[model samples]
Target: MMKGLVSFFFLLAGCHQAAGAVNTKTILLFPEATSTNYVSLKPTEKVLHQITVCLRSYTDLTREHSLFSLATPNKDNAFLIYFSPPNNISISINNEDIFIKVDPDVYYWKKTCVTWDSTNGLLQLWINNKRYPRRVTKTRSPIGPQMSVVLGQEQDSYGGGFDINQSFLGEMCDVNMWDSVLPETSVRVILTDQFSLTGNIYNWNDENFQVHGPILVLKDQYI
Candidate 1:
């Protein structure tokens, strides 16, 4: 009996640490919108001169919502993925907002990928295998370490200061982040299959991430 109790405690300890790749047929479901309900994603990598973030999300919210929030030190919006209403998707890199007007068909569940290169400040957004026109931002700063990545709530500060108004109310899964920007062909292949590529920085299969508030990890059938 004591042996089983010890194993149980070890399993509980695993729940709050680094996450492995359990996100395969699994989805991180944020069933409600609240300031406290969110998941904190830890990127194993530190410095990033370029970045590629890809994730699949399903939501019916018409108002503006935050899909991905990455905060570091004084730069609260160091790198963020935000959506407004029907088709306005904005990616904020180092507090500079670059908007991308996507097709209306992307309003539902879809796969989205965004890549940014600090060399020339080039940014590209791809949705459902189709790449939109790329844009150039003026911020070529390198994102340092100490990144606080959150899923549900947008962080006004480094790790705290969450507002319920911009909270995400839906399901998100297959979130992968690479320290280097992936090629266009690679992004196209990833849009077809979620398992085609895995993120070196933030692998979705890593099962050791922390869950705050009330979030559900359910199979695709439940979604």
Candidate 2:
């Protein structure tokens, strides 16, 4: 019994240590109306096998815009989150695009969250904590590194494609991303603006990105 207890304690300690190694960072972006306003990020993890984003969009125009994107240096491989007016939201993984319709209200702020897991190719989207149906794709491989991550403009090529027609013109806050799947409880925390659990790959409190153009900052409650 004594030996078993000692082994159990050791296992617990190991688990704690492993959890401590994850990166937790987040950021906020208030995109300008032009294509020049954007933010860029790169993760040390070569393959973004899984990812999640929690944010609110404040654009009221019925135009196409990009919320988030990640692509290789050569632009050959990529994943993207795009929004089109009249309640359309799309996700692109390795060039395969999947879309879902959302609420059409553009004036009111909306709590939005998206998650993608490459392991099983499960993709999920949540609005105001209410989850939509899940979609699956890109199960064969993971997103490679040396990626150009951007917020606001869609990457037509790898990292340098911007079209004014597809630029984001809105306030985005409480932006968070994780390299793994988040639990139900964590999702709730994010939606309520009481987030204590930090993202393993990107914590908003920590600076992990660069801002370009005229992105602004606003209160977290605006979302």
Candidate 3:
């Protein structure tokens, strides 16, 4: 019995150490909006990670009725991206979140990118590779601190009541994360997807972020 106990303690220590080594990396997901790719990530430290994406050309069906979001099955935290056809962009968080939408009429091509920085608590809007000055919304919760990341489709009803049948149809590429929020200027540069060392980046096109499996989540109330 004594020998067995000693072995058990050693095994437990090893398990703890391994779990501690789970560093937060960029989670890149390109689910068909109908499929969900899930991952559980608890940051070793609090940092701002940039979710890079290149939305595919908008379609009438999806543009009129669809949303892109990051959420967990717990329903405690959520960030929503919704834009109907014509001209309207809005973002709302049930809890700690940030996102942007482009007004098709305002911008002819409707090409733009936005950055959500958890560390600095800022939302950046970029148009035609130019950084536009805009007010940032502070998170009610500090980016959930630690969250189980879910991408592509909604996780049951936890995703702000998003229906799995309504998924985003687009390509998300060159996702990255840094231990700190990026400066406004840096966000403009990286929007081109040619920058090096944005800390950690998951290039969906590169296959670093894959689709398969159920994501993990903490029971904590995030937002």
C-alpha lDDT of candidate 3 relative to the true structure: 0.43
The per-prediction tally of clashing pairs is 11, 9, 0
lDDT of the structure predicted as candidate 2? 0.71
Give model 1's TM-score versus the native structure: 0.85
- Runs in model 3 lying further than 4 Å from the true structure: 1-68, 72-77, 93-101, 105-113, 116-121, 138-140, 155-162, 193-206, 213-223
Off by over 4 Å in 1: 1-24, 105-107, 220-223
Ranking the candidates on TM-score from highest down gives: 1, 2, 3
For every candidate structure, what is the RMSD over all alpha carbons to the true structure, in angstroms? 9.4, 6.2, 13.6
Q: TM-scores of all models?
A: 0.85, 0.78, 0.52
- For candidate 3, lDDT tens digit of each residue in 164-206? 4545444332333444445656665554433323334333223
* lDDT, candidate 1, 2-75, per-residue tens: 99999999986665332322333578889888889989988854779999999989988888889899998979
Cα error, residue 154 of model 1, in Å, equals 0.9
Clashing pairs in 3: none
